[model samples]
Target: MTVVISAIPWLVVSLVGGAAACVPLYGGNVRRFLRSSLFVKVVMWVPLFVAFVVAVSGGLLTGLVSGVLLASIGAIEWLRRDTAGRTRWYLALFVASCAVWPISTAQLAPPLWMTYCLSSVFSDVTAFFFGRYLGRHRLPDWINRDKSWEGVLGQLLGGVLGVLVLGMIFGTAPTLLAGLVIGAASAIGDLVNSVAKRIVGIEDWGSTIPGHGGVIDRFCSLNIALAAAVLLPR
Candidate 1:
């Protein structure tokens, strides 16, 4: 039952992610870039990391491996481009935070990890559908025009619903307010990433994820949302 409940969102995200990436409305370049982004983001990374976790026990060793691996990759990318002025400190902070997520999950309780994933994944998933289907007004067309108030609605509903369902399956119910807060945090994370991308002058983070850009692109919301959850009063 736990497996089934958790899987529901994973499947939904994959389907929605694929659509968001390859949809013809965006343009040929979008489809071309995002087509690979979706699968790599959803499929390759988590499973690969999970296997790594299993091997290293997702503890200190895992953190060390993840930090070194991510930092090395970031360094390689930086070297390849070699444009120091274009890169910002926040981008480095973002990458560092990505390393934190796996470490946090390895160290923290299962519920907290699930909270972060539930909020972030469902928010993105529902936002895609809501923005595409029901969205009429684009609230902030600055970085990502597709993000709408209506999509925010979907994120809220989906986040709340996803948390409640997870709670039910686990026989532990968090406050509805907590769910709302998580949803809001997830939205803020997404917005921040959008702004970061614009400032960095990149469409997606990298082609690492086939359709999603890179680990940084896909994991930004989860990292910030997790931090917010830690800071927020329960």
Candidate 2:
């Protein structure tokens, strides 16, 4: 409870900041702002550097640094450019990274957490690239076109393979199961965000991260995957 409470402010700031950033990316002034070298230098590059520092630090320090960095980036983006669709991809990546962090931290054994982290990253990265490269079969029109069965299968296979490799090293069912479940949940979270962005008619949730988008974009998968792991049995 204490940990959860402590995390709330950071979480809220991340979400709000990210949403604010998206305004510029999805707005109409993207091209005009891109031509401004000053905007790119101070507005774009600086916040990303700060986020990198915060993320690398990884603790209470991360929370404070990341929150401030995200807010600053969002504020700047909101005040500058507008480029839609691109932000969604960035957001997806961010959410995926966040999803893996808790699983990395929750393990009682350091080796187990390490294995889970490696496996989770491998699974998500493989699935993402594969899905993007080979995703031909789209879901029904009712579903978001951005998601495909190809991506889902890629996630499943990548996740299973990742867990299998990690389990071979760690030799633990609980850890393997946790990694697999978290990977699947991360994919689901990605789908949820895709749907949200589509429904809202925005691209990218925000432009806080240089390559990434907003806090929601960065942490959407992490939030869902962690929540699922916490609520589900085992």
Candidate 3:
């Protein structure tokens, strides 16, 4: 609760600024923009964003609850989908990572979890926005058709920006190097998830989140980002 309270101002800034910044990307096509998946994606992601903040920054009890919920949901979905057992090994690894992440981050001081989580979420947002608007070169067809160099750059920018914003709000700064590390980890996580989905011959891990496919789909970057954050010099 305290973490959430302290981060409210930062959240508002991110949300409003993101929306306003995206106006140019629409290229004056208001109706098209409203009808696009980008709008739906933003709307769907906001609620989950709050939950992630709580899980990472809301202390031991909240972390445990979030972990249990993540593990249960993830297991159910994996079992339901992977009837052929193509993903069992990966599923075990993912579930274990999900279960452990919140508990691991519980030891971090105030705003550290916030910084890491926000960096990850911001990386996703900026990557999607830039990729949608400016992507010219597609990544390898095997890795991800939707990813691009521009989007990767956006991910790095988002990471740096997240740390800078939180630094101002909390008056406790993490080095920009931490942001870069988190960003790179996030990009790798996303790519890895994409590859796994391709190997499984599926479009998403699940359809739990409306626009975002599944819980795993939404959280892959975050889990990796937090893991990377753990290695950052505190």
Best by lDDT: 3
- List clashing residue pairs in candidate 3: none
Over 1-234, each residue of candidate 2 has an lDDT whose tens digit, in order, gives: 232233334434533553344346435475554564323432443343344333434544444454455444543443343244444454434434443343334432333433343444445555655666688988654447766788777766666676566555555444456666867877887777676666556667565544457656555555455455555443
Candidate 2 global CA lDDT score? 0.52
- Give the CA lDDT, 0 to 100, for residue 140 in model 3: 87
TM-score of candidate 3 relative to the true fold: 0.88
For every candidate, C-alpha RMSD to the true structure in Å: 5.3, 12.3, 2.3
206: Cα error in model 3, Å? 1.8
**Relative to the true structure, how large is the alpha-carbon lDDT of every model?**
0.61, 0.52, 0.76
Ranking of models by TM-score: 3, 1, 2
- Quickly count the clashes in candidate 3: 0
TM-score against native, each model: 0.69, 0.51, 0.88
* Candidate 1 off by > 4 Å: 1-60, 67-84, 139-141, 232-234
Candidate 3: C-alpha RMSD to true structure equals: 2.3
lDDT of 1 by residue, 79-115 (tens): 4443554556656766676565456555645544554
Question: What local lDDT does model 1 show for residue 14?
Answer: 51
The superposed Cα distance between candidate 1 and the true structure at residue 220, in angstroms, equals: 1.0
